[model samples]
Target: MSEYHIPVLLQPSVEALVTDPNGTYADFTFGGGGHSRAIIEKLDKGRLFAFDQDQDAAEQAAKINFEGFTFIKSNFRFAKRYLKVYGVTALDGILADLGVSSHQFDEAERGFSIRFDAPLDMRMDREQPVSAADIIANYDATALHKMLGRYGEVTNAKTLAEGIVSARARKPIQTIADLLAVLEKFAPRFREYKYYAQVFQALRIEVNDEMGALRDMLHQAAELLKPGGRLVVLSYHSLEDRLVKNFINKGKFEGEVEKDIYGNDIKPFKALNRQVIEPSEEEIKMNNRARSAKMRVAVKI
Candidate 1:
């Protein structure tokens, strides 16, 4: 597990999640089974359901030998459907660590890291038909601009989009090196790495439909959790954190929360932490990836 992906906010997240040791729980992002292992250890007779779309993660899940653990090889968005198959309608708690795993980034062939010069394939599930390369090759300038600006928040999204269109017309951008050749011209001085990361992240999110999946999963989590059941999410980017925050506080993704006839906010979950929780300086020093993590805990109301 340690070699695969280090679990961020491990102790705090698990402690908050396992309020009832004998209750059913789910780990939506079973990257390396780190969180699932911890949750299983804390359980007495509790059943744990872990989900991950990645084949590599499925392989890791197979290594765990716990009677109470069930590994579901599917996207977390279909969590409710899969859990229902196991007769798990109501959950005690659900923990989702939302982001790409360390193993994915470290593996050069996965095309998740900026350091690698591999094929532009950043699908979480390699079985998926659309990839970063496909998006770059086919998307129009307007579509590309929206993706880069909205998902990546790239400053010069318009210019970059037009540039990509022009560059690809001459030759296709099929690999990491191919994209970088065009991207280098647009990147700011001494900030090439950051620019590359932003572009790659946008492509990854689109390829996986991450935001859409997250919205679906959150809605399912709200319906699946029992009263007072916990929903603990650790989001790495501002876009993910914002969505999690809105859903927990407002029930809906956009606009103000709706009120009932008696004027009570009709939200599903009550946030346990008023402010988003950040990793301690000590933890950040040990794991640099923890620096961007923002943990939010909520309880079904």
Candidate 2:
């Protein structure tokens, strides 16, 4: 799994992020070290810190023995606290490749992909006690329905939640196949794969508390970045993208951009791209995961 992920928008993201070769940088999600490797290559005397919560990712990070690179085996939500331990209070740039990695989905036993028959364990950090199975088995119908509709944007969230509640009462929904069987009727006949993806995404997001973690990281990133430092984020879903956009534009996750008494914007970062960046068709053809990636860059103001 060392040669696993092909970092989405690798060149463009790095080019936009790294303005000073001798400045500090962090890769918030160092999945297979794809983005970390690229960042390290551009650094001459700078230090690079890569964070990954997954134990499996530690093995891949071990392969990188660069002199100025440090790997942190924790979530990026704790970036500020952990980086202070490393004597890094501010950063020149911070890159967050959000959501699940390609390796996570490709690995059958990880239970991230619908293509596999495995336990419903989608914790990016496997050490976490709450797995997808736990959510399916324990979350109330209203909670499940809200998660599906809000995070996954599934059209039939109510029906799917009701179905899952009904089925789990008969037997525990322990595996992917079991959950699929319970929610199969709600899957659209023509877009079954899309429906399954949405349902699985909702469960995964809740189990990992991904949105909560993301918000924490964004707030920290604002404080960590130095003036003119770049904050490049590659989000795989609309929910993630919206959060990044709002935080960069308004300095908060919601509401319009606030201004000081002088009528100047009070945002910490300035949008680098007026429109969101996406992978080219050719790039998407090479890596299907790239199709959903939306990279947004901002400079800390």
Candidate 3:
């Protein structure tokens, strides 16, 4: 097993919530329990409910000895339902460190990182039917085009989708290597395969319906929060970050500053901060995975 994922923005995010020591909190992605451990240190009477869909996360969950910690083996999209099982109708604060854990990327078979040569399977939940290979093999050209365009922001989405269709006629694209071979047709001249990584990220997002899950979790988190509750989200990609920023500021992703028909602002949230927070240079120097992280925080009004 590879070293577990190091939690990004660990201190800053926890400090945001732990400021209110007695308030109940939730960590939506409890991989390796780093943030949860910090939250436990702050709480005296408050309890924490954590969620991680991956079975690998459960092993790390076992190591947490903190009292009043409930680690659920499920995804955050189902968080509302699971929290209900624990009788948590509302939370005082919520934090979601979204995207694959470093543990998932480093572990070769999990296939989250382009650094490791492994199967192209990038299911955050491994039991799920959809996998990167399945997307490559089954998705039609139009679907692939929109996936690359919407998620990856690739310029040549249509051409790239066509390339997959053409290449897959000869053999099933079953691994990252196979996908890379197909992707090379449009690979841009760049620094260290960043483009390839972006394309692979787009595919992984589509395969797992990650955006769909994120949308659900965001809406649910909003509903599950008590007035004055804090919502802090760490997003590694632009699309995720945009959704979070808009939800915090405008209360919607459509980019319209939501208001009553009379132009009175109608929002359940007060933007705690307009600028996104990033990892310190020292933090990124220690963990390169922190390079792309952007954290946004909102307080329920």
Candidate 4:
């Protein structure tokens, strides 16, 4: 399990959510099944359901033969409907480790790491039609600027977007190296790696529609959870953390919490922690990816 991908905040996340050994649970992102395995161990007569859209993750899921374990090969955006088909109308706890798995970033052909010069294919699910390369090649300057500015939060995003548009006109931006070649000049001299990561993150997010799927999953998770059920999410970036925080506190990604006619809040979930949780220095030292993770938990009201 450790060789596949280290689960961030494994103990804290699992312990925080799995309050009942005999209670039903769902792991919305199975990844390498580290958290799923931990969840299943704590369950006695409880049933566990997991979702993973990536084929590699599906293959990993097949290897887990734990009792009361079921794997769903679909995006968690469809979690509610899919679990309903399996007669799981309500769940006692739901967990989502939203970080890209080590396997995905480590695989050179996936184009997730800045160190790798592979095809610009950053789709979490290979079946997805739009790859990062497609976004780079097809997005107009305005669309590209929006993606980089909003999703990546890159400095000088507008300039980079215009540069990409000009560069792609001479030749198609089809690979990681090709895109980098055009944007390298715009990168901050001392922070080139960070700039590349931001660009890649934006492209990956757009290619997979990560934010859209996350919003859908959160809505479904709220509906799927029983009253007082736990909802745990570990997000790697601020964009995702913001959404999770908003949804947990306000019941929607944006705007203020709605009020009922009786003058009480109508939010579906209440946040468990006043502030986000971070991994310990020891944990982050061991798994560098854990450094950026922010975990938030909520209880359904």
**Top-lDDT structure, candidate number:** 1
* Candidate 2 lDDT (Cα, 0 to 1): 0.91
Please report the TM-score between candidate 1 and the true structure.
0.99
> Can you tell me which runs of candidate 3 are displaced by over 4 Å?
none
Better of 3 and 4 by TM-score: 4
lDDT of 2 by residue, 203-278 (tens): 8888888999999999999999999999999999989999999999999999898889999999899999999999
After superposing candidate 4, which stretches have Cα over 4 Å from the reference?
none
Per-prediction TM-score to the true structure, in the order listed: 0.99, 0.98, 0.96, 0.98
lDDT of 1: 0.95
A best-first ranking of the candidates according to their TM-score comes to 1, 4, 2, 3
- lDDT of each structure? 0.95, 0.91, 0.86, 0.93
Q: In TM-score terms, which candidate is top?
A: 1
lDDT of 4 by residue, 252-290 (tens): 889999999998998999999888999999998999999
Clashing pairs in 2: none
Worst 10 residues of 1 by lDDT: 108-117
Q: After superposition, how far is residue 292 of candidate 2 from its true place, in Å?
A: 0.9
Candidate 1: tens digits of C-alpha lDDT, residues 57-150:
9999999998889999999999989998999999999999996899999999999887989999999999989989999999999999999999
Q: Taking the tens digit of each residue's C-alpha lDDT, what string does model 3 give over 25-68?
A: 89999888888988999998888898988898888888887678
